[model samples]
Target: MATATRRSATRTGRTTGRRRRWTAALGAVALLAGTAALAGPAHAMAAASAPVDFATHCVPPPIAGIPPIDGTTTAQITVDNAAPKVGDTVTVTYTVTKPAASNPVDLALPADIMTPTGKVALGGAQTGSVTVTGPKKNPPVPGKGSFPPFSMTGTFKVTAPGSITLAPGDYNIHTSYIMELDTPCTVITPPAPVSETVVATDVPGANERSIQLTTASGKPGDPVTVTGAKFAPLADITVAGRAGAAQTADRTTVKADAAGGFSAQLTVNDKATTGIVAYEGAAWSAEKGAGPAAYTVIDDTPAPPNSQKLNSSVKAGTLSMSQAGDTVALSAVDFGAGGASTGDLNTVTVKDFRGGPAGWSLTGKVTDFTGPGGKIDAGRLGWTPACTTKAGSPSTCVAGSAGVVGSAGATLASTPNGAVTGGEFTVGAKVTLNVPAYTAPGAYSGVLTLTLT
Candidate 1:
């Protein structure tokens, strides 16, 4: 009998990348059609044994989707031989298809044989385009493994028929192989592909900080001013607002010498009754915010003085007078008194017009008066009377500019307002009136003055 071969295995397949000569192995023919003799004295003897069937399987399914992106081709192998006896060695062989074939799928094993019934069987994996190497004498028949070529077909055969002696139980064989792309694949780059990013741009600001106007509210015959700050010189002014009129520089304008601001004027009647004045369109350069922001033609014409406050002191001997009127109107009229400063006792003739003695006497501690700094000044207006008496001091009542009744021609007094007269009461001014000999007492009156200061 042939002693079991000490070492043996053979695998072969066609390789597309490598031009190696193809090797072929005859796969084990299927089980013998007729049954072999049952194991008895002869059957269980070293010569009595049944041929084993060969099977193939795979792990990490080759066709499955994963890292490979494409499936792999590979396979595991198993063998079955029953009734083997000791003292017999075996050889196994397998064949795998060429990688070039789209479905080149196969694997093979060689130097295979059944082991003695009481001996441990051999098992393992066989993979690669070429035959895989395994334990020297097929160690134990059934074994497991990991392989890559995921999708390939395989078939195998067991040579060394005389190597195995005998066996009682059915002996099995096993081996594994991998599946990988026989034909390499590559990706082609896309032609003319485009990528883009957007960047934003910012816009700068313009001129024009603010705009305001004085007396923007007025009737058609009344006044309206288109005013604001940072207004350029000779700028065009319009009032399409209430009365709606566009006035050019020379015609409807006011300019500054070194001052950068100016004023514009317009008038409106019932046509300008609307409370709103969508007045903008004022242009400027190098100003804050946007240019010419719209402005409401507000009734800047100060509400008629809510109440006029008069500031001054009166002496029984010193007479004085003052007047207050529409400042805007006053500024325009500038009615200086009759040669005398405004509120500067124009015609100091006492009269019932306000208060005086029985009839009215123009003669008092003072007759005519004047002032500086828009203040009323009087020298000849006061009289050193012969009466003396001081409710607050030593008893003495002097006849101060005695209260007297004069003829109608003597009681007349008149001093127009809006005149650059009197002392310089720059900011705010006051006017005063007195009746030397106020007949029936309580002297009161509403006096309007249009003075120029």
Candidate 2:
């Protein structure tokens, strides 16, 4: 009986192993079916191709007898993808057929020199225009017999869900030789007969992110408040300001809140140009994550004062000057066979707040140096002046030439009358004193005065 029980247990174990294998196979199949269900259905639309003809009126180059050329051209347009979801990009190709007409005059059509650019009108679900451009692949035409056929491509993003129709519109052909010659061609009459259609499907929660700005205009060093919404929660986002041709160097990164929203601030660059700057926010993992807020950079230069007669009396502004220190001490030198001693003079600052166009000047005068060795003439003291004007100020400061600062005084710096916007200016100099040989040993001191007007 015991042996029989052992055999029975082995048989049961084999049966259970087979049952587990069968269950695992069924589970694998069910997982695949669930994945397919989540994917829904295939939404890709078949590619479409069509032919279009245009009755073009082209303005040809000026030759004594050559007038405008009215001709018919053929093109084949192919939509790479006719069905795209919202936020998807689609590419369309425009292939032109070589014209049979001969050149009116001898023309050298260099490779890639002839460029064609035009817009394709959109209808149906979208109401806007898409720009198309072709690479410079035109074969060199020694004396144009018939223009070669070429292809151009354009791409646009699907913004809305619906059927979008494309119709060929106006375009221009540009050729450069001795002078730039652009032939503007217009589609004549009944419009282009051929048109292509694209269907855009809606993707839930796609391209819903948005960015807003607190202010639309600012000057350099100004702060701009940026806010973002409808982004992924806790997502890392980068926000930046961009101009048409210039890019701002400022950017900030922040984390979205639990509600899929974020807020940050960015400062404008000091050298930013005046134009419409778009502040954009983007996230790497999010599709169509970029959103733009337009900001204009206004010219910070204050407008000129309006000329008006005031009924009340107005106080006049003032121009003033001050020195960093009261006195300048030269390096002590031995009197035995002396040559010269030099030291840096104290810095002098001049400020002009007067709102008028009248300019000002700064002068420096010195008294005779006196000590135990009698006195030294002030004319013996010379200085090389250095002048600097404040940054971003319209004022232009000119330093005075190197010369002796005697009792009569000498120019240290000056501003021209063209400086309508007064600003602060700083002046510095290196003072030198010439001592004769066999001079008596003693300490000398001199008083220097600076005057501004």
On lDDT, the leading prediction is: 2
Question: What lDDT tens digits, residue by residue, belong to model 2 across residues 259-308?
Answer: 98888887867434222122225422225353333344433343357752
How do the residues 1-453 of candidate 1 rate in per-residue lDDT, one tens digit apiece?
001121111322221110111111100110001111122222232221222222222122244322322322222221112211221111111112111112222323222221110011222111111111121123222222222121111111111122322111111112222312212221112110111111111223322223333321222355555443433443443332321122222123344323345455545434323221222245311222111111122222322456532222111111122222212111111123212111222211111111100111111122221111222223211211222222332112112232221111111122221101111111121122322231221211111111110
Which segments of model 2 are wrong by more than 4 Å?
A: 1-47, 63-65, 99-104, 142-144, 208-453
Query: What's the number of clashes in each of the models?
Result: 111, 0
Cα displacement (angstroms), candidate 1, residue 82, comes to 97
Best by TM-score: 2
